[model samples]
Target chain A: MWHVDEGTMNAYLDGELGDRGAGSGERGAAERGAGSGERGAETVWEVETHLASCAECRALLERVKRVRDRAGEILASSSPDDVVAPPFEEIQARAEARSTGSRVLQLSRIKRLAWAATVVLAVAVGWYARGTVFPTRTEQVSAPLAASELEESAQSQEPGAGSGEQIAASGEPGADSREQGAGSGERGAEQAEEGAATVVAAELDRAVAPADRDVAGRGAAAQTQTPAEAPSTEVGAAAPPQAKAEPDAEVKLRQEVVDVSAQRRRSDAGDRLAAAAAPQAVVQQVAADEPGVPVGGIAVGEALMFEDSLWIAASEDEAQDALGGDVPVIPDLPVIDYWTAPLHGGEMVRVRQRLDEENVLELIVSRVVSDVRAAVALRGIAAEPAENEAQIAAKGSLEAVAIRRGDLRVVLRGPVSTDSLRVLGEKVR
Target chain B: MPTDWAVVYRETYSDLVRFLHRKVWDIDRAQDLAQEVFVRALDVDAENPRAWLFTVANNLARDEARAAVRRKKHLVLLKGEAEARAAGHADPHAESVEERERTDAVKRALETLSDTDRTVLLLWDAGLNYGEIAEQSGLKKGAIGTTLSRARRRLVEAYERLEGGHVARG
Candidate 1:
């Protein structure tokens, strides 16, 4: 008697090995496993005789049956009718579309490669032509130039005819040519500074408009002072002749512009930082009937110390005045006593104080931050799952919780119980 | 004698789509591939039309499976999923969240199996006989049962692991 392999036994269990034309003995074994009666009774008797003795194969068969049954349940749930294929017309249209799409994609790829190659060739040709067409200009000679030559050179470099006359009239023919070059460069630098100062002042004025008119006024004064200091500095530097006046003026103007632009940039940057750091206020105004706790604004970065008894409180009006906006209020909860105040940062923090019968106080301070992800890595709290959101798990004695609510993240820190923390977190609208 | 093409189309179209749906995970794509099989079948004269149909459908599915692998950066597939949802193409039979999740878990589990195992399991689920599946899969007719057994065990294990991940994420 040939022994049945595990695969044959498994197939027999699935009722899949019934008619595969195996050896008569193997077929009898499969027929017995499939529970086929009457016609295969002799075969069943023979298979059962083997099964009764082979404990290992019988146990393996039971395990295969369990897996097959479970998988069968999963497969049966996915009905063909559950997915209604589009009408035949749509299927035909899609097949045709796919055929056409592949052709179009191939053509488009070829077109793109050709266009790219052409663009590269055009860019290469343009760069080479630019190098040949525009050769570098020669330096000016120290020997005094005739008025016409100076005018031509000055007109080419600078459109201003006045600059040509200054160089021609200097009368000193052997003045270092390098000095003249330096003077021209200094003047160009000065003009650039003046332009930059004007733009910065205009931008600052626009940036600070209406909200801080005083800041805009200072920015405008700085703009004007930058160009104003340039001329006097130039006069002192080139005292030889007024012909050198332009260079001295240019040098001074350039220096003043740099100073003013740097100051304006720093001021602009500070204002931007302040605006960005302005805490996001999450407000739940106190219920009119209950009036549980009054909310007040506290200065930014300053923590209000509570001695477990004095409990300094502020009304909504006081909080608004302090925070420059409406204050976020903490909801009343049974297990915890709430003392609320606005922090100077854009966020409002609610401190929950739990007082035991012995008068030992536990403090939990929570606030909204712009991002919860940035604060998730605090020293103690690990993230855990809560309903609809995730909460930070408390480590040992220190309990900290942070949950994201829309664009803002509400964080809680203290020894508050998990239930109390979740209750408060949900209250942050 | 040539086969009756209309009779063959009428008999085989729905099963072919159902078979492809289990492979592709998208009903629209399955229907398109099924129709494409018929379009190719218009040119063939086979004595065993049913086996021939399965063979050609398998080839088309294999080609698409390879193409999908090559196009693994799924920005297009993500956009397609979003568009499909908007168009109400999601599983209509899912009655509850649990059922939908189970179906999704099963689909993901099927993805983890070897291509042959997945094909055999899906073909069996689509009501293919062992002999027909063997013909389509190029496995011996007697070996189909063994393959099905291995495929079922692996699928259940993969599915359980995926369900565990969902719990962890939650």
Candidate 2:
């Protein structure tokens, strides 16, 4: 007969013994006999018979029972809780607060991005307006005066005359009269030329004339000469008394034209100076707006118009020079549209081009600097026609608000379905 | 539907806290960790709230035990001169609290016997018969008589040592 080992007894205590106990010889035989499938007197009798005959096993069983009882007594007396638990509501509140805090933090980040976009747009608009208005006025007032000066220099150099020599001493480029024949034959051209000459001659006659008699009376008789008539006939037609009356007026008129011409030249020079300075200012502004972005090239498309200024497209080299370095040149960017507006002190020209399949690139140039400052590209697919129409009709709906703020782009990419884009647009923006 | 954490907290807070406190000796740490366990339990499916709570509480106790071993190494390093100085500066009331904490540690160590020994002992103490013990513990009915006898001897040995060998066996 095989006896139950200490380890087997321990395994029994731990409840790990399964069918292996059935193979342990006589004890197993007795257990098998006791398996009556009934919790009755017969089973107890068999168990008692086995135990009463086995003195050593009975002593072992009694010892196990005593140890089991002692251990239980120790645990029962020393029960775990003398301490209390914290309020359950407090923990629930903390979890809820954490969830809400994270949501608030996400919303705040979105708000900051919106504010940044607003600031960028305002600055771009302001910069573009500044370029358009001032330069246009400067161009207008200056060009006519320069043209008049050229005409005066040409008239001063009549080849044969000492008066022309005297006028040539003024250092004007057209002071040598080499083309007197060209001035005479074409009737319409000659008439226009003669009209300008008459105005100049009358002014000269008035300057040499005496101050007391009326210069206005002499000037009225001189106006009767046909523009097609010879310059000598017009000069001879002027009344001597009228010519003698307005010497000071002639000098004043001559001085006024010269000063106007000179002022225009100065303005042109100022424009060039401003143009030279504009790129640096634009770069500085762009840098200030987007720190750490290295600027390589600034280019504008030919169709660009910002406010009243017209911007012609620039070549890669010109754009590189403007940007101060060679940038990743995207050549032949298709022109989408232009915006013309009066702003700042000149014309503002903004040229938009499609940078890629998804992005629209906008380049803004100021007429004053003729320099491009910002180049922003909007990225994402254009909304479907139906969606756009719905968006428009939804006007002031949540969907419209989201599209206006570019939230629709994020919604489109989110796990939410395409339809959810419309819903999110309506709800979140 | 989400498991209602409030209801779970109300129903099982005391029992779970007591269960954990028995496993982990520090009442405050056990209570804090028990709340964490409940919060984790709330994520489980609601149909088995008791089973989920038991599983989570068991996991938390096991994790705390591992952490305690790590803490013991660090404490032993500080316990030499630095701890002596710290203890010396502590108030008399604080000293008494430390003494009570040490006694608690001794009691907790006695509770961590093997599952079979613990169950067997607990069943016997509860006055279960050999047949009931076999049914509860899954031991063979024939083996329960022998297993209980040995478990009793081991408990007596442990108890005598705990009492400093002064208490005589009845």
Candidate 3:
């Protein structure tokens, strides 16, 4: 009989041999050591049978055990004595602080926007599975996601407030003369917990919303003639009245719902919710002329979208001809891009502009009959409440305001305070 | 599936600290690194959390070692250990001196190990099973036992030699 090697003998001494509660461990060892898990157990038994017959191997086992015991004794002596861990809360708090205020994170402006987006998604998933972990600390996000939070951190607005002012003040797109808008302040720590929750959703569910294909101005980069409709497989998942009460409810947007898992987030819902909550957390500054935020009162803001719309870029005249009327502009805001697309037997003219580097607004125009009002139904997170009848569909920090400009109706929506949306709606002429 | 981070944090924090303490030999520094490990971990849901914590702790300790060299902090490691141990003793002058000597001897023996040997031994002591050690240390499972045997023997011999040297000097 072949004698057992020290490695095998030592394995038996260490209980690493496949004799007890070692099936998987043995198999893992075989895959790692012998390229077959069976070998670990076979080797253990062989060593055992061999040691029983061979005095030499048995003698070696005694020597190995002595060494093992001595080593364990010495190693135990140096072990850190009675180490007490700080509460998990302390670590969580530190992570929040680091994510929000750390220099490295601050340098990545896009990352903050991404993290905010992540938090929205995470919160939706978390809430769906187990409801909100806790209520918002600051006036950031409300259960129905309060507009009062935006009042603290955003440019205040009354219904139909800033149209004339924004139009007169508007010079160019991205000018510093813009609304101190949504998602700009330091909502980092307050939202970091949510960011963690969504990481799973982001990784597991990759079916994505249609990527916005930019066709109007800025550069040739936006001018690329890619497919007008990118794959919108998962984006369609948001539809169903049932979603408001059901954890596994599908997201409802554009009045069409797809069978996307409710465990994942509705991208548009996340976009809107984060946009709604971002202003107070990332407050820019109050523009001197805009009104103060509405304290406890819910602001009734009108919103519109083209339901059966094929979103794309086209010229202003083409848009007007398609809609059988003239498209209006928000006077003071810089026009970043102008897009036109047919909707509900009419046409929609979209004016894309920036509030800041990260916060963007899309001012959309259509004939009143062809326009579908913005009805963002988030599944179970902040389901529709009775007082929220006229609530803008944007979930967190997103706000929408629609106003009638003569024959045309225009709606402005983005990650902004509803008050800001109201003020900008007043500027469209 | 989403990880219940609160449970994982509670279970693994102390083990992470113990593992880190052995690598850096500073309880406070170990605790700080352990906290950082959990902080990063909050953003992720790892399949094997204990293994993940150890892997991160190892990287942090390695970086700390490099940073210490750059700072040129030529700390008398033995003296630091003695002072640390003495600070906790009920009677500073009595058992602490002997405790410090024994600790210094054990630490010196551990230092004699090759990087692979020391890591394997420390990982085992830190509660990793053979499979976890193999996965984390990039060692074959069949080879772990051999490494452990060699590590144990070397540790005992080195400690015995240190004790003998002290006796001869006395």
Candidate 4:
């Protein structure tokens, strides 16, 4: 006298109630009724038995059948106009556009990255030299000239700033130099030996600018900083002649400064406060406020707090300026902050942060290069190749969304949905 | 081995577009999105192309929905202007007002169901059998029949309610 439930009755009507005889109750019910000629029949036998005596369930089945019929008719009646297939040509063009757009974006990203790295290294060299190279002369220069001419001087000397005295002078501020000179006058030789080692550490920053053609020369310059090297081989001797020979060096210096500043403009103004000068204040504040942790090979210096209020305060113009006229295609997001460092073979690592509506920070890590072979190389221990390279995959607890768009291999991480991550990944370039 | 992308595209394009058209309400957009699904598919090596297409198509539709929210006001203004243009001249559209009413009625009916139920019903309508619908919808195969039955019943009830209102107004 057991009657089938509504769900079972529905399954019975759809012929989906195949006999799951692993269940004892279902098996007993099937055994009590029709012998197993058909599995579907055996599964629905309980329902069939109830329907033979119960007009209520039979009427319900009839109603369900009618409803299903009407739904089918309505759906089928949709005009072909409502679902016209796009011409194959249009589809192909769209496909080509997607592929080409990604390629173009990647190429553009590589070029932009080169420009960005050039600017960063130029800025570091410029700022480092201003205090040490010609401290008194730099103070007398006009502000605009100070920014541009000083940068040119740095670039010219960049090839040969290898003397231990100049290295110690450049690494420390003007005040620190005077104090060290006064305090360590008796130990001048020992101080010079230590300064030589410090100069090598500063060369680490030089390695971050891959696009710079003088990488080999810079490496040579670093080696020349050894105290063992004769004072006669000081880079200052080579700087004056090189500056005189490269007249367009000033124009190049200005252009590099303009390009670098423009890219920095895409991020928040709070971050821009650090870019114009040595950001000694910002770096010091960050160091005091947040402890550094190593992620991958790089040390994440500070946790940039993502605030919804500040995010809303960001204007559209700044974003456009940062991207250098190519607007960030991602809607309602501004690049909050960014960091760039060099990778091997004329490639650079670019990290950008953007906040979602919920104020969760999404970090986009990209290698701006023409080839993503290095990016794919890191995927060796990944579970399996996804359907496509861009598809999101779970590697351990972290979900890594890797996209090889043009030359950029973008990996985005955050507490966002996969769809959001996908959109954000596409916008990295 | 996975089916050739060209073969999968040819076999599933129409059904996929139809399913998307119901979700998006614009044939051209649905078709464009359909092509995007295939373009994305070029990267995916799926065991079941049909299931993959539907899943990707669903995600694309969700993205479109988010974007549409930003354009809703602009669309409302365009709709008003179009209606004003239609009033000034005899409507030249091939379908009569009654046909538009019936189409809107079906849309409203489908809209009444919950997301899973509606998705199940639409996938079923798109010619995916119970097992296929289960894979696409992330529902169990055995439960798909129950889901379908419930969706069909609700859809009919909603349509009948709308029809009753139309008759009353007339």
Best by lDDT: 3
Per-residue lDDT over A1-429 for candidate 3, one digit per residue giving the tens place of the 0 to 100 score? 345555666677777777544353333433333432223333466567777888977887788888889989988877677778888899889889767744432443354455546656765663442222111211122112333333222122122221211111111221111221223233454455544433332222222222110100001111111123211221123212222232221112211221121212333443334223333212222211112322122322222123223466776666666667766776655667778654322446787876555557787776654442221111112112224422333233445555667656666776544555666666677
lDDT string, candidate 3, B26-86, tens digits: 6778889999999998888899887888899999999876654422221222135465344
Residue A233's lDDT within candidate 3 is: 27
Off by over 4 Å in 3: A20-44, A102-429, B74-95
User: Model 4, which residues run further than 4 Å from truth?
Assistant: A1-60, A78-84, A87-93, A136-429, B74-94
Top model by DockQ, which number? 3
Give the clashing residue pairs of candidate 4, or none: A266-A322
lDDT measured at residue B84 in model 2 versus the true structure, 0 to 100? 47
Q: C-alpha displacement of A270 in model 2, angstroms?
A: 40
The per-model lDDT (C-alpha) reads 0.47, 0.40, 0.53, 0.50
The worst-scoring run of ten residues by lDDT in candidate 1 chain A lies at A299-308
Q: How good is the docking of model 2, by CAPRI class? A: incorrect
**Candidate rank order under lDDT:** 3, 4, 1, 2
What lDDT score is found at residue A11 in candidate 2?
37
lDDT of 3 at B134: 91
Residue A255, candidate 3: how far off, in angstroms? 73
* Candidate with best TM-score: 4
Task: List where candidate 2 sits over 4 angstroms from the true fold.
Answer: A1-61, A81-91, A98-429, B1-12, B46-48, B65-156, B165-170
User: Distance from true position, residue A372, model 1, in Å?
Assistant: 57
Residue-wise C-alpha lDDT for candidate 4, range A210-295, written one tens digit per residue = 33313222322232223233232332333344433432432344344344434433433322322332233433343343222112
Interface RMSD (one decimal) of model 4:
7.1
> What's the DockQ for every one of the candidates?
0.15, 0.12, 0.27, 0.25
